[model samples]
Target chain A: MSPKTLYDKIWDAHVVHEDTDGTCLLYIDRHLVHEVTSPQAFEGLRMAGRKVRAPEKTIAVPDHNVPTTAGRENPDNMTEDSRIQVAALDKNAKEFGIHYYPVTDVRQGIVHIVGPEQGWTLPGMTVVCGDSHTATHGAFGALAHGIGTSEVEHVLATQTLIQKKSKNMKVEITGKLLPGVTAKDIVLRIIAETGTAGGTGYVIEYCGEAIRDLSMEGRMTICNMAIEGGARAGLIAPDETTFEYVKGRPHAPKGAQWEAALNWWKTLYSDDDAHFDKVLTIEGESIEPTVTWGTSPEDALPISALVPAPEDFKGGKVDAVRRSLDYMGLTPGQKLSDIEVDTVFIGSCTNGRIEDLRAAAAVLKGKKVKDGMRAMVVPGSGLVRAQAEEEGLADIFKEAGFEWRLAGCSMCLAMNPDQLAENERCASTSNRNFEGRQGYKGRTHLVSPAMAAAAAITGKLTDVREMM
Target chain B: MDKFEKLTGIAAPLPLVNIDTDMIIPKQFLKTIKRSGLGVNLFDEMRYDRQGNEIEDFVLNKPQYRETEILVAGDNFGCGSSREHAPWALKDFGIKAVISTSFADIFFNNCFKNGILPIVLPQEAVDTLMKDAEKGSNARMVVDLEEQTVTTSDGESFSFEVDPFKKHCLLNGLDDIGLSLEKVSSIDSYEEKASQARPWV
Candidate 1:
């Protein structure tokens, strides 16, 4: 067992009780729901004759299925397939008495992004959502993770969840990150080294020089994919970066309470003698801009690497590799740089933050997108969109052949009208590379925002280093 | 239904990885917030043909595994998008326990709230269970939810542990809000003190 880190301290504080079986019943401080998963849970409550257990603690938003196009006359005019889905979420949230920030809400955005911007996500809270990106909230020094629909129902009715304690894993990234290597690159490098399932059965606490140097948005991006590497959640100790990010948010504490909150947050770090079940260290400068070439996040490679051949895998893993290759329509031993893309999407809870937009805009500056490639840039939040426009980044995107759209989850899962045609390949900034994750039979290559922008200009999988 | 005294039955074998929520229940079915009707459409894409007929080759359609109550799955068993429908469909389809080498954090937590026990076992333990599940459809396993132990038909027993707090709540069927309400009196007292000290609200 490790000495209490901030994560352990928070866990102990929130623990209602422990069972003989070692499972803990945790009280969720905040519950964020979206259209996709909340409806069924609400239905389960209705079936059991139960009202929402604590409506005030729960906030709902329509993100995954919301359209990114600025304004549409009606739901019917929204030609995207996910429009109907968003409307359904709208109706369901209303009937359940949950506070739903609809698309019309100036605050509307991806659920993970919306939670933090609205000050609904706070430090020392246990937050859960029906989206894996729920881990994004953990950057604020909270114990946040994603949940499923059945659990959603349970929380709706009970406002608590049963969970087993996870082993502690500390991944210390030392040294300064090299230029052109962002937090996305660092996480991708970790995934590449550890494989996707490396952090399973553990909550990973990131520390050391490189991690502490990242901005709050950058830390959020790192924590967001704790799930991608099979970790329960990823977190960073709250510091000046965290405090500065939360300073003037709508729900953040004010005045004396604010000072008290900062004092408490500053205490959120691992003790010097704290031990972890596992510890892995990596040099930040060694990481490069990365992209996924296979069907899983782990099947990623540096932009300069060739597509892996089936023979590259050991033993029975070759079959899965072959299957992924077949689904992706990539030839064995092909140069990854030669892979052409038809669409470029630079938004999602994963990379919709203002910093992500700016990173992409920086690469798009003075470069025109390929003649036939379709590109769209959706901001993560209204504030992010407004800030980008104020900074003149939106105009750069528009001039570079990218559609500057309203803040929403756009082309992340093809839940909205934005989708790839059958067999089309896209450079997407969203997490996940499962077959048809963007649409029916649509192939996707997961990349960073800069990589997505670089690919948009080159119309292929080009190394972002060249543009940077 | 009788207090869910003990969880017992065969654990089905599913070797697939990264089984996402969308695959468990498609996006089209998300229109209604209701959870009851989703079980039938669970794994619709894999279970059905292009014409919507049940695919004979699908794992669930296999005769021997039809009545399985426990699912022994592969690594990252619940990955990709987070749709709670995955667990709902699994529960409604009669799965009570999911034993795997690993599980996505969200899906793992979701299992407990729905009365589904998601067990994380070492690869060796999972391999043994997978073989046991593959032997026959009627293979029986006993899971004492109270004891936190899983026993196979051959009398092999594995002692597992859950958080004591969650155990009490599950045993009493209490949730977070319920637990908080249990302490309402104390909260009210604190509120009264703060109000008196401030005299403003």
Candidate 2:
């Protein structure tokens, strides 16, 4: 047999039919829907008089619109549109005979976190969601990507998608990451090198020693922001770390089924001689606890570097630099360490996992948040929150002057009340630094959980390494 | 969905690069499931001020471009998020087509399903259309899907490419899901084989 990339092997296996125009019908294994995007897709299905072809294969998760505060028990008290969107999901799930985990349910969380926790996401399967962070499931080697709600409806009516193949690119990381550097830093560094639009029309497969050294949660942080780099999807070949995480989960195969699954999954990696369209390599030792100074993910630089001037750019780059600097309200030669922030947000699907909290808690231990600075730590899932409490991480956060909130995508995109003030600078662990992402006119600087803790302690964008 | 053959209407010019979906529709306005009401809030942060007054300085709110029927944007328009609402808001605002130097892959695909034609042209061609669009409401442009061409009112024509399958669906107003379901038998057989070979999955 010819050597094939991991993507090619999975894609070829799922092709239902190939059309002459280089498009094919690919069978979908699982469909994950959230509150904000699924309502309209459900409406489209009803308008067409079409019932879901495979309700058993779909899971409805209502996370994006739910309130993270304690008073969320009464959905009516929520904002009008938010209540309507969430209530619509409950009704749609009942009408469509699909599984749903509402905010009241213990299982409810960010779709990306809950899907894998419940074992609904498996290796070698194709996963589709209406949210861009659907790529988070690619940590298990699934061919996962975000789709429009129109495609959501299409998938609901038929358990397949009319997808065209994408080019395959590999990013190889060599050497070992420095102690303070993390999975988020590596992905941020890659995005900075590749730029925001670099991965267009391609699937990025993260490989090599540094990638293999990370845990399943760490790998997920890398895959979650592949869309920020403009990649269609990000993948990491499943290995022992992936298998161990899936072994005893609720939906994972039980008893003898596990043996059979692992036996097949062992062959899911790419062969040494597999051909790739493009391969970019990075030295992991060069990575630092990175931070974004501008509005885009690709606008990151190491803490040691100063904000780059627009004049330092070439090829008509001044426009982008000037716009980002103008919006972020940063000077051209400003150093990241000299920047002070009004708030620190340590949550998001990107860094709200238990491991992320552990990293942050390690820095916050025996320390107090700076005076007049507000900080919050919101876990990604109810499950992660429980694990954090079990480890006493929640108490550590509270003692350190960081507000501990219930689980959701709180302060990530700030759909709920957890938001930054007008013109307030924030050190956030969430993915994007797009202008006003957290709130109206709120300036955000993206960092890792450890760095967010360091920023809180110092009231500025301080390096986590020296603090540690 | 609306069928696309040709269109002639005023084109709005937005020359900013990486016009992400969040910019088109902020998270605050993403609450409603309905697509129609979003037009009023299109470009919510950019089009409106903190107190909800229209920011007249923004291009879309200008008197001449308020009723824009087509959009001539910069490179990588709709560059972030996979929200179909971006196209929904565009269609709700009476935009029949969007012309850009290039588009993010997910957004480009979403436009077709929502009856918005996304045209990809070279930078030089886009610059020409953008200049023509600056002429305000009088500079109406034409997009002919049948010919795969976009023409400015000034007699400049630029040919483009479209996927034959997407083109067929748009022209006939055919069901994309129905066409995909035509291979139900093949899908069932493959599933049967897969389940048998890998029963644990």
**The best candidate in terms of TM-score:** 2
TM-score of 1: 0.87
Question: Worst lDDT window (10 residues) for model 2 chain A?
Answer: A312-321
Off by over 4 Å in 1: A1-3, A16-25, A43-56, A70-73, A78-99, A150-160, A314-316, B1-12, B49-56, B62-70, B119-125, B128-201
lDDT of 2 by residue, B112-141 (tens): 998888999988999999999999887889
Candidate 2, residue A153: how far the Cα is off, in Å: 1.3
DockQ of each: 0.32, 0.69
True lDDT of residue A33, candidate 2: 88
TM-scores for every candidate against the unseen true structure: 0.87, 0.98
* Cα lDDT tens digits for candidate 2, A1-468: 989889898898788889888999998888998899899889989997999988988999778778887778698768888889988999999999998888878788899999999999989889999989999999999999999998999899888899999998999999899999999999999999987778888999999999999999999999999999888999999999999999899888888888888877888988889888988899999998899998888899998789999888753246777888988889978898998998999988899889999999999999999999999998888899889999999999999999887778878888877888888999999998887788988899999999999999999999999986
Error of 1 at A49 (Å): 6.2
* Segments in model 2 whose C-alpha atoms lie over 4 Å from true places: A315-317
Q: What are the RMSDs of all candidates, in order?
A: 4.0, 1.4
lDDT of 1 by residue, A1-468 (tens): 656876787787566556566656676778998877766667666766777767877888887766777565367667454565567677767777777887777788888898888787777778888777788998888888887776677677666776677888899999998778888888887877777778877888988899999998888888998888888888888888888888898878788777766766776788888779989899877777888888888888888788999899863357668878998999977888999999999988889999999999999998899999999998998888989999999999999999988877768877667888888999999887876668767889989898999999999998888886
Give Cα-based local distance difference scores for all models: 0.78, 0.88
TM-score of chain B of each: 0.85, 0.96
Candidate 2 yields a Cα-based lDDT of 0.88
